[model samples]
Target chain A: MQFHTLFSKAVPLLWYGSHVDKCEKLTRAPGGTRLCEASSIVVYKSSLLQILRLVACEVWDHLLHFVTLLTHRIIPCLDVKAGRVVKGVNFLGLRDAGDPVEIARQYDEAGADELVFLDITASHEKRDIVYDMVRKVAEQCFMPFTVGGGIRTIDDVTALVQAGAEKVSINTAAVVTPEIVRQTAQRFGRCATVVNIDPKRVPRDGFEERRAEREKQGLFAPHAVIPDGQPDDIVFEIHVHGGRTPTGIDAIAWAQYIVELGAGEIVLTSMDADGVKTGYDLVITGGVSSAIDVPVVASGGCGSPEHIRQVLTETDADAALAASIFHYGEYSIQETKQYLHEHGVPVRLTH
Target chain B: MIGIIDYGMGNLRSVQKAFESLGSQATILTTPDMIDAQVSHLVLPGVGAFGDGMTHLRDRGWIDPINDFYKSGKPMLGICLGMQLLMDSSEEDAPSRDQPIPGLGMVKGTVMLFAGDAYGPGKLKVPHMGWNSLNIQQDVSLFADAPENPHVYFVHGYYCSPADSNVIIATTDYGSPFCSSLKQDNLWATQFHPEKSQRVGLKMLENFAAC
Candidate 1:
């Protein structure tokens, strides 16, 4: 039995070592590599006697895996319309999911790393309703939450933060003012500031054939263009006011600019992938994630756990934000996390 | 009742709500006088720059009253910037001043920025945001009956480095092993927000209430 235990423990060490290259992005933070090195050495020395028996591998792998698992965050987004959690496809065709507070509580119990509430139809008079809803949601759950939609000024950010939001995501306001992002970050620290980027792939010459190729490649369906190796004469143009208006700005370049302007994190959502669930826009997601030093959350186009695994492993995104999959009771957060773990995409599973 | 010191920074409501959920009444103390005879425990909850934090605390006339409360031998808890405020000084906003801003000096340590000279850049994220596992180094009252290596929510650019390693009850690795929680006499402090950490965090707050 002891030999069997040792063998089981020793085997995963080799597996972990072979997969170390995949974990390079996990150590993006400064001095992170040194910490990994120092800890492994300490673990080695502490179990020196077990080295010949190959028994310390489990301990080393466990510690290192815990560190790397922090890289990927699974966020469940609640698109709120008049206080109810609503679901929409391609940023339109809204359907009721459930009560905002109730859904938030459910997500909390399901081990969602964070929760996002976007007031889809936010207006001046109805601001109080959103505040009350945010406070209620905050009261029920104990995880970090972000509130976005119609967040125009520092006052909006402050109100949400005061109402129990850890981070306030700015979308339309960020495009209109641009300085609000910097101001919010300066006041509440960069970590509390998040910028949501909604971009649609601009149609170019021969767009139909290219989109068909993408559909064949299995990224998306119904004429969704996924960028290939070549530039392919496509630009991801930014959209605002809940995807109703186009902003003529490039998504990748806008992401880079906002990060420089003190946006600590970016939530990149593909307008085309809003409810498709085929997968995240890997090409653009990867582009924005690599272009910026800050963390990027790949939002939209998450149908199955496989889609999540693909985005996390294939792209540089630090997290995956989904709405429809979790909203419709298709799969619980635990199942998704379990799937990711089995597929070698590290995620924190809390019981 | 637990007294949460609100010196014009941080989300004190969440801390208060966490305690309320745990069947404890947490009152937000705006003024030093608000830390009256009814308050049994003191919670210093804050976020933002260390220099700004100190300035606000001093401006609100919280220094002397807080020190007095500490001397009263009651359980005092600090969260995030509130934890940093307990230290001797901080490197945040140091360049603008001739000398580093002084903390409460209840503990001997200095607050250092993650991207500052110590950890340098590109190794770790500036603000060690999100959930991380806590490496419990000592069996303390704050973490009594706690699960092994419980993950907690953390959001801060600066971390507290206590002069005495003995005070460190837990250490969480973010680029390197930085102090995540510390305990000294009646004072218990954590760099992570127990309020936002979900079940494990709620349990910690329950433990703190019990203490």
Candidate 2:
């Protein structure tokens, strides 16, 4: 169910474009085997695209770097409140970070593949974000950046994209008017919109019993991981309005639905792991990622460079979003990327 | 002055800004008349659908001027969709079950989507958004002073498959090594955005502008 109240700005994401044909020739070739199915990497192992192995060291580095960049993104997320970057624990206990424009400049200089700006209080406060801020930030960064929070209508998405946002996110509004996704996709192109799904973990007791029961029932069951002393494996529930409320929607199901609706990507945030920084909710992220044909950006609870490395390596997520870790200078985006590159995750390094 | 055709599509500002950043004056040309004595080079920047872009090029009456500029023996560049428009036709409309849209036919090729949905499990997303290496196929001024296999920014769902592979100056892998940049005489086009690509992109734009 959609939350009736908004305590803070909840992130909504939209992805549209029949490629919006960004470049006349850099076409995102439209045809393809509809949503790849259990394909083999073996197909590419001997292909030219995977020819990094035979090249000389330096060329190999450059080629693999390109591969890493094409497949992964280390996105610096700015959780903006009152037009300033802020960090909150569990979407509460907010701490002032810095001015958005300047911090954005820092991320750009530090080699962020993409930038995400969430007006953390826009939805909770029920106010439209200032397009001027979006415009200012867009001008400051050459890389494509996405903005989320409190966006409810086509005009909201249009205003943000027009103000230089390559992508506009929809969270709470998606629950209220899911069709907004279709309308925005039709108008903006399927690649321009993204659906932000913040799912909270809910208890599913007798997990072993349920896993066995589901297997008997033939539900195409999820992988069961029952930790010691836990009541059963947990299933994630979609949340809206700043993680203040939970919906009946299943996280993986929602991800699949959004992609079918033409949303280009899913920004899957884990409420259970929001600000503790233990790490991302890998189970849900990987599950949702595998369930959808589009890219899934794993958000929430990144405490260190290793955390970014963990989410990316351990999950199928195409990108990872972190706020406080980068904002407070715990790790520069370059450091995070370098760590990833060193650990063999293949991130583009900025000199 | 470098004249950027303002056929009313795509990210035009950044291209102009990129040229400005390189200490060159790039102007957005909306009318064919603006293709004047002051402007030595032309750029066609594009975004949005091919049909709509062609309509804008037609409604704005830029088809003749752009083609004429190509004939003037002066250098011209088409970025992204502007580059694809130089091809003969595109399959971007195929998803709607519509016939392939016709293009300017400047380059011999048919623009089509990657095989399959170009989306889903175990496949690259159609937009193929992000940075990738450009495999330089030939030594052209566009890549002069640029590094070999330079990584450039790309964001597209369809790609131009040139009938004449020789015109393809460079190739970038995304399902396969589709044409990433192509040059024929003074006419240049890139699927990747040189403006957003930082150094390499700026260098290519600068090289084109220098002519």
Candidate 3:
């Protein structure tokens, strides 16, 4: 089957770090019966050293899968805050990297197939896109580039495209006015518009302890995170403004809706995996990729070439986008591609 | 000198830059007076829907001037939505549902939607997004040294199906073989965006510039 057809049935996987232990202990199987099947463990130890070990393990697993098929993309995302390339240190605070142009050049030379420049500060100001940054990056960058942040109207998209940006990504504005996607796609072309979905796993009802703990502590409890409110109900909720607001809509349903609304591609960024430098939340990537027919670009927690290999193998993503690892010069594009090739994954070689 | 007709569509800057990238001078002309004064190659680029775009051109009384410029027989090119407006009519109109809005009529075709097994049954995904290979149907100066089956960027849902298939110089597959480009004498139009399309797209623009 063609890749697009397979993508239609792709299932998104949401990573709940070790919540299985809590579920098994908290709720006794009815009459102490073996109610639930043996738990599937998906754990990510956030320690720097442990992450490195996990990276090695994941690479080995990916290498086995790569021998069978050739697909997957390594994408680098540049988060722009206040007109500078900024990455959230552990998804907490932002650090500036001076000019976007210089940083984009580095990524381009480093071998990023596609680049996403997200204006992280646009929603706060409620302004249109700053074309100057777009123009600067577009001037030097030679790869397919997607620019998000502060895209409010057709004019904003037109300005970005005119300034040399290939695709205009919309998130907040898309939520506020869903028709904006269709309108922009109608005017600019569907391929020119990309819908960026930042989703977070929310506690389902019936999972009361997890809800209570989350409410009181003002933090996510990893163990009780999967909402058990609805039986056999695994719901992924869509969040806007960098996972700051819950839209009360199912992430899978939203992904299908945006695609119907003429979105050329879907950029799925796992809020849980973002900036963690552990790995992509395979569960979410798989779930969303399976739901939408358009190409899915997996975003968030990509730390190594092994991480890139695992994402393409485990998830249905057409491409995997990372920031910190590539930006910090931990790996070069040629090195990653060569690694993928050696591992049996099909990747475009630089001529 | 390439004359870029600027009728409020948003792609003038990028198109001009593409021409400049190829070492060609492109002048964006918005007024009929300017187009009349400058008798050179003409490029009509647009970014919005067909009906509104035509309305703006008519509102500014550009139809007559544009027709006059076309009669001059200098090379003329239309990009993306501009290419769509070159048709005799389009099905994309809402307010003027039954009305047949006039296009440049340089090519004898009407804008229509993609049909058959490619798009499947349901809501059509307009604005066929992303990079797709262009199947060059004929030898034309517009392509110049560009590679065959070169991937060009596309962003529109509706495409121009010329009444005369012989005019279609290039075609691309997106659910179906839609006319990606058309050329008649000195008149040329591309459904794909050359400015946004990287090397190959620029090459096409450079061909236009050199022509």
Candidate models: Cα lDDT each: 0.77, 0.71, 0.68
Q: Report lDDT (Cα) of residue A52, candidate 2.
A: 33
- TM-score for chain A, prediction 1: 0.73
List candidate 1 stretches off by more than 4 Å. A1-71, A88-97, A203-232, B96-99, B116-123
All candidates' chain B TM-scores are 0.95, 0.94, 0.91
Q: For model 2, how does the per-residue alpha-carbon lDDT over B5-50 read when each residue is reduced to its tens digit?
A: 8875644666777788788998988688988989899998876678
Total backbone collisions, model 3? 20
Per-residue lDDT of candidate 2, residues A193-305 (tens digit): 78899987777553345445545765434544332223454756677889987555567766777777768778989998888999998778867775665678899888988
Q: Write the per-residue lDDT of candidate 1 for residues A1-351, one digit (tens) a residue.
A: 125323433454456443343233333323322433553242223333434333344454344443432546899888887777666322112232457776666677879999888887656778878888888878777788989987878898989888877788999888778899999888887888899999887755444554455457663223223343436577677788878776656677678788888898899999988878899988788777766767788998999888898787666677899987876668878899888766666567773
lDDT assessment of candidate 3: 0.68
Better of 1 and 2 by TM-score: 1
Ranking by TM-score: 1, 2, 3
DockQ of all candidate complexes: 0.35, 0.15, 0.14
Docking class for model 3 is incorrect
Q: What lDDT is reached at residue A237 by model 2?
A: 66
Q: Which stretches of candidate 3 lie over 4 Å from their true place?
A: A1-75, A88-97, A103-114, A122-129, A137-144, A150-167, A176-193, A206-231, A257-265, A276-296, A303-320, A329-351, B36-39, B94-102, B115-126
